[model samples]
Target: MTPLLDVRELVVRYGDFTAVDRVSFPVGAGETLALNGPSGCGKSSTALAVLQLRRPDAGEVLFEGRELTTLTERELRPIRPRMQPVFQDPYGSLSPRHRIRDAVAEPLKVQGRWNDTDGPTRVAELLDRVGLDPSYGDRHPHELSGGQCQRAGIARALASEPRLLVLDEPVSALDPSVRAGVLNLLADLQDDLGLGYLFICHDRAVVRHFADRAIEMREGRVTSG
Candidate 1:
């Protein structure tokens, strides 16, 4: 069977600097493929390239059988919703000015799936699905704890009904006490949705506990798996 996401000889460069080089990997449905490495190891760059947020300098990003690198922005728009990102720094990922409800609702609106009648309900459901109380939607990012903010971000990602999630150090900033809760929530979501995860994390312990398989990187190249 085909994988949900496949990256072949991916390379990302900036002027004289190369951030990711000749990296290849595949994430299968319901599997968590962790990109494990320290800072400046090209994990985040790979994630961005896979999402096409920053197109790779060379190589192919195949998502559900489509090559994303060759697609124009217009052609990529519809495909974007099926693969979402959950970034590190929970608070930084969300806009402080917007209520959580509006943040979650924006994806629906952008995807042309929003209706005044069911939109609010859907947002509430997403919040609840991620372990947030629906009423918490009225609050802004500043009103939430790190863990709660991350949950809110996950809710926003879920709003897109994504099949794959590129999780970039998702719990690194959270308090240790709450990290397990958030990780457990993610595992539950993956189990329930059969979602493929490109989980980028520097913590080996976390990666061992959370990821089904891990690929280690150093300086932009895949060192081992």
Candidate 2:
């Protein structure tokens, strides 16, 4: 069966520096593939390249069967909705001005569901789906705790009905005590939504807990998995 995301000998460079070198991996449907390594090991670079946020110097970042590397912005727009990211800082990811509900609803609106009669209901459902109370939808990012903010970020990412989530240091910013809940929430999400994850992190312990399989990187190359 075709994998949901396939990274084939991907090479990403920054002038004199090679951020990612011929890295290859496959994330099957509903699986968590952890990219584990120390800082500057190219794990994050690989994730960004897959999202087409960074253009790779060589190789392919294939989604399902589509070659994303060469897709124009116009060509990539439709596919973008199927892949979403949750970054390191939940507070930085959310807008201070927008309420949680508005933030979650933005994706749906952009996807042309703006006029749908069930828009509000759908937003509420996503909030609940991410383990946030529907009432929290009225709150701003500032009013929520780190865990709650992260949950809201997850809710926003799911608003697009993405099949894969590029979770880059998802639980790192939260308190250690709350980390388990957030991680458990992610596990539950994968089971319920059948979501594939490109889980990037520096901590091997967290990766062991969250990911089904992992690959190690060093100096922009895959060292082991």
Candidate 3:
């Protein structure tokens, strides 16, 4: 089967500083590939490069067999829906001023698909899908707990019906008890939605519980161990 996403010898650098060095991996359809490493080991950098949020000094990123490195931002617009990301910090990612409904619907609105009548209903459905109460749509991000806020972020990521979701330390910010709940929720979502996940995390326990395959990184490179 063809891989859903492929990274070949990906190298990301900031002037003289190298953040990601020659990392390569493939995430097959419906599989979770975990990048396990300590902080600043280039896991997040690799993900950002794949999403074209950061330009790589060298190497290639292919989504569905097309090279993303060669594509302009305008050319990448349509493909953006295929590679949605759920960030590490729910609070940092969300706009404190926007209601949950607006936060979840922002992607759709940006894509120019929002209709006044159906937007709220769709937003509610997404919130509910991620285990948030539909009624919480009226609440702002600050009002929700960390886990609930993360759930809301997940809902927003899924709003685009993405095939591959880059989950960057998704459960790290939650309390220990809340961590398992969110991790299980992610596993369930992957199983039910047939979504591929590139799970970037430092916790081996979480990776062991949720990932299909694990890749360990050190000093900006994939390690043999």
Candidate 4:
């Protein structure tokens, strides 16, 4: 079978600076592909390019055989829910004003799902899926611990039933004490939901424990893993 997500010869630049050079990889169902690199190695750029949130200077971002790089934002709208992101800073990514349920429900609302009979039910299920109590939906970001906030973020991402998750340092911001729990939750989610993951991180230890396969980058190019 074709890979669920493929980045072939991907290149990105900032004016004269080339941030990602000919990077390529594939992520299959329920598998983890870790893109490991130090700061400024373009790992984040590659992740965003795959999602078409960042434009690539040249390359192919193939999601289930569709060429994403050529799609306009309007054209890419439907594809967005299929590939969601969980960023490093959970608190910053979420709206301080919105309660947890609303945050998770927003994606469904964006897709015109608010009127669906099971919209509320789905939100509850997603919160449960991410290991958060469904009752916590009433809480705001400040009311939750960092781990709880990240779990809520993941719940929000999963609200769309995403098949591939672009986790950009997903566990990096949480307390080290809680990192293992969050990573374990991600692992469980992959198994339970059959989700593919493109994990961008700088930690080798994390990769060793979390990823099914790994690639390393340095100075804007794939080095080794």
Off by over 4 Å in 4: none
Error of 4 at 85 (Å): 0.4
lDDT of 2 by residue, 44-158 (tens): 9899999999989999988988889998999999999899999999999999999999999999988897766899999899999888889999999999999999999999999
lDDT of 4 by residue, 86-170 (tens): 9999899899999999999999899987766888899999999888889999999999999999999999998888999999999
Task: Return the TM-score for each candidate structure.
Answer: 0.99, 0.98, 0.98, 0.97
Per-model RMSD to reference: 0.6, 0.9, 0.9, 1.0
Model 1 regions more than 4 Å off: none
User: For each candidate, what is the lDDT?
Assistant: 0.96, 0.94, 0.93, 0.93
Indicate the TM-score of model 2. 0.98
How many steric overlaps are in each model, in order? 0, 0, 0, 0
Candidate 3 lDDT trough over 10 residues, lowest sum: 216-225
Candidate 2 lDDT score at position 40: 91
Cα deviation in Å at residue 4, candidate 4?
0.4
lDDT of 3 by residue, 53-144 (tens): 99899999999999999988999999998899999899999999999898899999999989999988899999989999999999999999
The candidate that achieves the highest lDDT relative to the unseen native structure: 1
Ranking by lDDT: 1, 2, 4, 3
Per-residue alpha-carbon lDDT of model 1 for 1-225, expressed as tens digits? 999999999999999899999999999999999999999999999999999999999999999999999999999999999999999999999999999999999999998999999999999999999999999999999999999999999999999999999999999999898999999999999999999999999999999999999999999999999
For model 1, which pairs clash? none
